[model samples]
Target: MIIGIDPGQSGGIAGIDGDASYAVPMPLIGKDIDGHKIAAQLKSLTPDVVIIEKVHAMPKQGVSSTFKFGMGFGIVIGVCEALGIPYRLVTPQAWKKAVLAGTTKDKDAAIAFVRRAYPSIDLTPGRKRVPHDGMADAVCLAEYGRQIMGNISEVS
Candidate 1:
């Protein structure tokens, strides 16, 4: 099984376990980054491979926000190490380029991509039907894992 995570406070995670596949919000502690709980969730999945989005400091970002993002990134990496789980890193550019090229692929594009890739998956809620970019991004991340590290399959 392959587990994919986008390591951001507003990000999402996706994984395949046994015969099920799920894409959901990244588990976190109330308002803080909680590496232990994240690790526990990953451990329970018993994934053979874990792939995380490789991100960096972008321009025009404030110091505090940048610091928090970096800290969260490190925490996720540290949790993987502590559990001795094998992981692979994929940059956002690399993955996005592989799936979408020569276009300004924004959140909406990501949602569309996931919908196209998994036409059967239900991505929206009942009332609002709001588009979920985080979930879409996580789905794409999992697909990137399949591209680079063959043999992982989506849930049926």
Candidate 2:
């Protein structure tokens, strides 16, 4: 199994086990708090690999976002490393392009593409029936990981 995470002010987790995909939106937390959540999730899944979103610091945005993202990412990395699960960090652009391709750059467009890709999966946002951007992004990362691994198998 492989899990892909899209990290941000709010983060998302997507898991691909065999041919199935599952995703959920999660609150971003401090290192101490997030470590517990990561452990719980990892314990449930027991994934063979964990793919986390690479933190890309934007210019002029101060250090707060970077720090938060980095802290969140660190907890995830630590969990994966300790469990001996291989991990990969993919860039936002790479995941977006892989999922959206020629679609618009808007979040809604990306969500639509995700819905189309995983029509059977339920990724609705919030308590309401809206699409979750974070979850959708995570799904994209999962699918992208699938594609990459599929290509690698073909090459080998």
The lowest-lDDT stretch of 10 consecutive residues in candidate 2 is 147-156
Best by TM-score: 1
Reference-based lDDT, each prediction: 0.76, 0.73
Q: Which candidate comes out best when scored by lDDT? A: 1
Task: Write one digit per residue (lDDT tens) for candidate 2, span 1-156.
Answer: 777777664668888877688888764454333666767887789876666778767788779767766777777788788877777888777767776788885688768977787777677755757777877777777777777875533211
Task: For candidate 1, report its TM-score.
Answer: 0.83
Per candidate, the number of residue pairs that clash is: 0, 0
Please identify model 1 stretches exceeding 4 Å from their true place: 17-19, 101-104, 119-129, 151-156
TM-score of each: 0.83, 0.82
Per-residue lDDT of 147 in model 1: 66
Give the clashing residue pairs of candidate 1, or none. none
Q: Where does model 2 exceed 4 Å of error? A: 27-33, 151-156
Question: Least lDDT summed over 10 consecutive residues: which range in candidate 1?
Answer: 147-156
